[model samples]
Structures are given as structure tokens and as C-alpha cells.
Target: MSSARPDIVVAIDGPSGSGKSSTSRGVASRLGLRYLDTGAQFRAVTHWMLSHDVDLADPDAIAARAAEPQLQSGTDPLQPTITVDGEDVSVAIRGEAVTAAVSPVSAVPEVRARLLDLQRRIIGDGGIVVEGRDIGSVVAPDADVKVYLTADAAARAARRAAEEGGSDLAATQASLASRDQIDSGRATAPLVLADGAVHLDSTYLSLDEVIDKIVSLVP
Candidate 1:
């Protein structure tokens, strides 16, 4: 057994549908480390905003209510949970409405600050595999290991469409492109490959292959 305290953190950054979440969770489970989905946290907040009819275009309004909900995230790899304002929001956060508004909500500086503080606290506690757009670039810049995953846009959109079960290919492509633009262009914590981060293009790799590569990098 490794004598280390297991406090080592792995930061996985990628655009949407790049398979970072699945790979991070699997790697965490295999290595007996905790898993954190930063995207889910953003989605949880977005879910709250939508439920409360907050104007997503207004940064002040989003930031004002940043702490309105108590968001809890489950670290278990097999089953993750996200609760907003004491309500289980694992499913609700993924709705089309929330998905459509999440980019705008997440782009707000205040919302990012609120969530970034929480994310740092989560990592400070112990070992974790954190997956998000700016985890390596912003939240956990000193992470023990950083990986940037990507794939061709078409491949990424196709994979996402398949997961969504019969999604429109053209629409999915457009949505993915739009999200990429927003996530990469946002002022705060914009998505970018961190300095010295291991780059993995997952377009042709199998899930197990990707997981194996990541596991090999863990100390």
C-alpha cells in the first residue's frame, strides 16, 4: 500500500464531451481517491438560477445569489450527488433548461469566485480528481498532476449526441461549438491548457485506454 496520505490531487481540464468526467471518475475509483465534478457544481448553481428566474445576463444578480443555495457534491465515483438549497439536484441540473443557461451563469465572475472558493476547500481536505474547464488553469494550478484532454469537434459532438440518446447531430455540433467559444473566451478562468499539463487527444482512444494513461501518471 502507498504510505502517502492520498492528498495528491489530479486536475483534469477539457472542453465539453471530451470524456474527462468519465476518465476522472474511473481513475479516482481505481486509485482510491475522491472525485469532484466542478461542472456539476456550476450546473447545480445554474439549476438554481433557472428555478428562481434569475437574469443570467446580469453578473450582479448571479453573484448576489451565489451563496443562496447550499450546494453539496458527493465524492463517490459509483454514484455522485449534487444538492442545491438542500434539495437533491443530480437530475434537475442536467435538464435542457439548465444546460442552455449554464454557460452564461458560469461565465459570471462572482459565480466563478464563489464556486472556486468551494472547490479549493474540497481539494484542501484530501485527495481528489477534479474535472472542469479551468481546474488546472485556475482552481488547482499547483495540482500534483494536470491533464488537458481534447478531441476533434465532430467526434466530441457525436459522442455527446450519443450519450443524449438520439440528439440532432447538426444542432449538437453547433451547441458544442458555442459552448467551446464561451468557455474558452470567458474573462474569468477561461478554458486553456495549463503550463506543463499533459495533453491527451482522446478522439481515437478507448475509455480504458484513456484511464490507463491517466493512472500511469498518478504517483
Candidate 2:
């Protein structure tokens, strides 16, 4: 495995279940760099909103309270952590309710602004692998290595279902489809393949293969 230069930054972006998290963490761990799951940070904020009874259907309501949650993300690839207001919510953010509502919450401009500040602070001075829907296009456009990872719809659904431990494949597929539509259509920081990013289709690749490919791309 190749060791990362201290000033290197890897920005990996893709739709949900496209192996952004796994691939990023693997690359970061193998290359001796920190990792940030930006999706999990968004999920953490969504979990907080839901817990506070924020109206999911009202974007204004969500924006009004966007900065209420104090989110802290642990950058260690091996044992990343996410906390909201000093409470650990690393696992709770992955639950069904948060998953269902994360799109709308993330779409709020206020919410994006809030998290953008946090994300940039965490990504300071590089030497980190940041994964999310917009890291390449928006968060870290000047990153040393940028990757837009993707896979076929059915393959993505199956991978997500397996990760969630027996989620119905069809249902998972529909859910991912819904998120992709929302994420791609959102006005602020919508998902897109960044210019100069290596477009990697991982439909036929193993996790290790994916990680190795990204690792080799670092300058």
C-alpha cells in the first residue's frame, strides 16, 4: 500500500450506496490519512432535526433550526464517530427515519451552509479522504485527487441492502432511486461529477479493487 503525502486530499463523491463510505475509509486507512463521511454528518443533522420535532415537509422550519445541532465528526477511518450536541449518534443516524428524511433536510440551504463550514474546518490542510454527494463539486473542488464513484442502479441497491443487513432489495432500490432524484435536482450544491474528477464505475469491482484504484490516483 502507498502512504499518503501529508498535504494530499482525496475527494470522493457519488450517490448513496455507491461505496463512497467504504471506498473512502479503505483508501484513507490504507494510505494513512484521516477520513470524513460527509453523508453521515448530514444524516446526523437530520437525526437531530427529527429528534427536535422539526417539520420534515417545511423547508423553512428546517432552515430556521439548522444551526441548532452541534455536530462533531471523528476523522479516524477505522473508528469514525459522529456526535450531535455532545451525544453520540453514529448509529442512530443510520436508522430508517433519518434515512427517509435526510434528503429534504440536506436540501435546505441553511443546513448546507451550516455543514459546509464544519466540513471545511474538518478538511483543513488536507491529508483526509472526504466522501459525500458534493465533496468534489462543491466541498473540495481543488482537492489533489477527485473521484466520482458510481454503479448500476440494481447493483447499488443490492449493495446498500446488504450493508443494511437484509433490507428488502426492491424497497431499497426504490429508496435509493428517490434519493438520487432529490439529490440531483436540489438547487443548492446538487450532486454532479466534478470537472477533472476520474469517473469510476464500480459495478464490477470488489471493494479492495475500488480502494486500490483510488489510492493509486493520489499525487
Candidate 3:
């Protein structure tokens, strides 16, 4: 938090593997603020859908069932948790299958609508760091610090692969590309840098360096 700024809201938006999650959590933890990972919200919904055998390819089906899951997000930067229907799903939501379906489930207007309300409520009065594809562009456009983080596809894939226990780099790259296409091409609240947002290319930056630079931007 800056001396001149009170109840600061930090919005970090970017494509997968862009380091948005790590950066947001780091910044929030250092600043002693709450943190929210909105992508987890989408993943939680996708996990619920998969568990229920929802037809993910159909938008109408997704929209109709979007509100059925009771999504809860814990704001602890040290131990962020996402649960649905009282079940802790922090790890389950990160599975490859949930990753594959999250984009479509997130694109549904009704699903976004449902999560947007929850997002706003969680971010109320703004002492929080929020990270997701659309957080800067839609969820927290007026945030005190809006950062749109990006990296070259190769770097992004490498980071993701490393995080996923040294998975195949080529396959990870392709998956990231596919996710970028779906997330950016969607008609509603597409992934984008919000107006006045600071764009940081983290392709060569260390996570702490990114966090340091953003923390410096506060005042």
C-alpha cells in the first residue's frame, strides 16, 4: 500500500503461463492485502460441470447450470483456496481436464455474469489483488494498479511446463496457444489490457523483479 493510496486494488490480467498468478500472489502477500484468483473460479465451475457430465460444448447448457455450484474463494495469499459446494477443490481445479474446459465454461455469458457478481463482492472496497484473463479489462477496470502481464509463447510454455513437473514443452505451447485463441476470440469480456493499464513483458523478468516493479508503481 502507498501512502497516498488507500484500499488499493491490484488487477493482474494475462494469458495462461504469463505468471499472473505468481506475481499477483507475491505482490499481495508483500503488501499485506487479500488475493483472489479468478481463473480458479472458472476452473472450479468446469470441475463441477465435468463431475456432473454437463455438455461443455453447448453454451446454453453451461449457462443454465452456472449458478448451481456454490463457489467460495479464500483470500489468503499464502493459501488461496477455491471450493465448490463446500468441497475444497484447489488441486482438482488445476487438472488438465479442467484446464481444457475452463475457457469454454468461462466464456458463457451467464457463467461470467455469475462469477462477476462474486468477484465484485470479494473485491469490495479493494484491499486485494485479483488475477485472471479479464480482471483488468472487466472485473477491476478501476483498480488502483492494473497490470497486463505478457510473455512470448515459448517463455510462457516453458514456465508452465516447469510448473507442471517438466511436462512436454511442445504440447504445453500448443495448449497455451489454444487457450489464448479461445480466451481472446470470445465475444464476451475477452482477454485484453484495460485502458491505462501498465503492460509488463515478463518473458525475461524474474518473478521477484516483476513484483518489485509493480510494488514500486503504487504511489
Candidate 4:
């Protein structure tokens, strides 16, 4: 613990592969605050739907069962966990299958509504770092520090491929691009930089550099 004030809340929003998870975890760990990966929450739900063989193509089908799964997100930055129906799915939710379905599942209004309430409940009283597409825009609009972290498409793709052990660079880039389009165009809380947020582009910045810059932004 750095002895910093614990009531501060940091909101980080960005497209996929922009290092939101890593950066948010680093900030929370450094400041001794809780960490919430809202993106992982969405992935957990999508994974459950896929596991249950839900008709993901039909919004009505997804909406009808959106509240069926019991989603729990552990807020520890060092060991953040997500479980669906008491099953620890921290690793399973990161699969390519869930990745492919997450956009559509997340775009469904009912799913977003359910998660938004959960996210807000987890963020109560601040002292946490929340990262997601809509964290700064909708989840924690009045966070003490709001950062819209991003990078060039090439950099983003390369980082994502590296994280996945190995992936087709061009394909990864294309997927990221497609996700950006869907996440940004959704009628619900689309991906966007919230007002008064500091835009930090990490195309050339090291992870520590990015963390340091964001940590400096704390009041």
C-alpha cells in the first residue's frame, strides 16, 4: 500500500488490445485500490451463453436469458477473478470463441443493463480502478481520474497477439477493427471517450511509462 487516499476512483476506457487491463491493474496495485475489469465481466456472460447453446444471433433469445447466469467479479488486481454460476472461468472466458461472440452479446441491451448495475455496485464509494469500453462513459462517469488510453491499430494488434501467445497479426488487427466498429456503433453505451477524460496514446510508451503517467494524474 502506498498510503495514498483510498477513496479515489480511476476510470480507464479504450478499444480492445489497448492495454486497459494491464494498465488498470498496475495502477490499482500501486495505489492499493480494488480493480474491476468490466470487459471480463462481459466475456464471462458471453462464455456462459455459448456454453448453454443460447441462440446468440437472436437478440430476443439473449435478452430473455440475460439474467440467468450468476456473475461474480473478484476485484483484486493481483488475482482478479470472474466466475459464472460459481465456476471459476477466469481463463475460459478469454478464449477465441468468447471473443467472437462478446461483441454481439455485449451489444444486447438487456445484458448491458444487468452488468451496469453490477458494475455500479462494485464501484460504490470509489477506491478502485474500473476498466471497460463504457467505464468512463457510463459506469463511473464521475470518477476522480478518467483516462482514455489507446494506441495505434498496429501496436494494439501486436500487443494482443503477443498476449495470446501467437496469433495472425493481420487477422488480430482485423478483429480489433471489427470490434471497434460494433462497440462504437451500438445504440447503448457505445465505446467513447467521456468528457473531461485525459486521452493518453501509448503507441510508443512502455507499460511502466503508461502507468506512471496515469498514476501522476491522481489528485
* Rank ordering of all candidates by lDDT, starting from the highest: 4, 2, 3, 1
lDDT for position 98 in model 3: 94
RMSD of each: 1.6, 0.7, 1.4, 0.8
- Model 2 lDDT at residue 189: 99
What C-alpha lDDT values do all the predictions have?
0.89, 0.94, 0.92, 0.94
Scanning candidate 2 in windows of ten residues, the lowest lDDT window is 1-10
Where in model 3 is the C-alpha error above 4 Å? 1-6
For model 2 the TM-score comes to: 0.98
* Off by more than 4 A, model 1: 1-5
What tens digits encode model 2's per-residue C-alpha lDDT throughout 1-219? 569799889999999889998899999999999999999989999999999999989999999999899999999999999999999998899899999999999999999999999999999998999999899899999999999999999999999999899899999999999999999999999999999999999999999999989987987
Per-residue alpha-carbon lDDT of candidate 3 for residues 1-219, written as tens digits (9 for 90 to 100) = 433244899888999999999999999888888999999999999999999999999999988899899999999999999899999999998888998899999899999999999999999988898999888788888888889999999999999999999999999999999999999999999998789899999999999999999898875
TM-score of each: 0.96, 0.98, 0.97, 0.98
Model 2 Cα RMSD, Å? Answer: 0.7
List the pairs of residues colliding in candidate 2: none
Better of 2 and 3 by lDDT: 2
Q: Could you tell me the C-alpha RMSD of candidate 4 in Å?
A: 0.8
Error of 1 at 157 (Å): 0.7
Higher-scoring candidate on lDDT, 1 or 4? 4
In model 1, which range of ten residues has the least summed lDDT? 1-10
For every model shown, the clashing-pair count is 0, 0, 0, 0
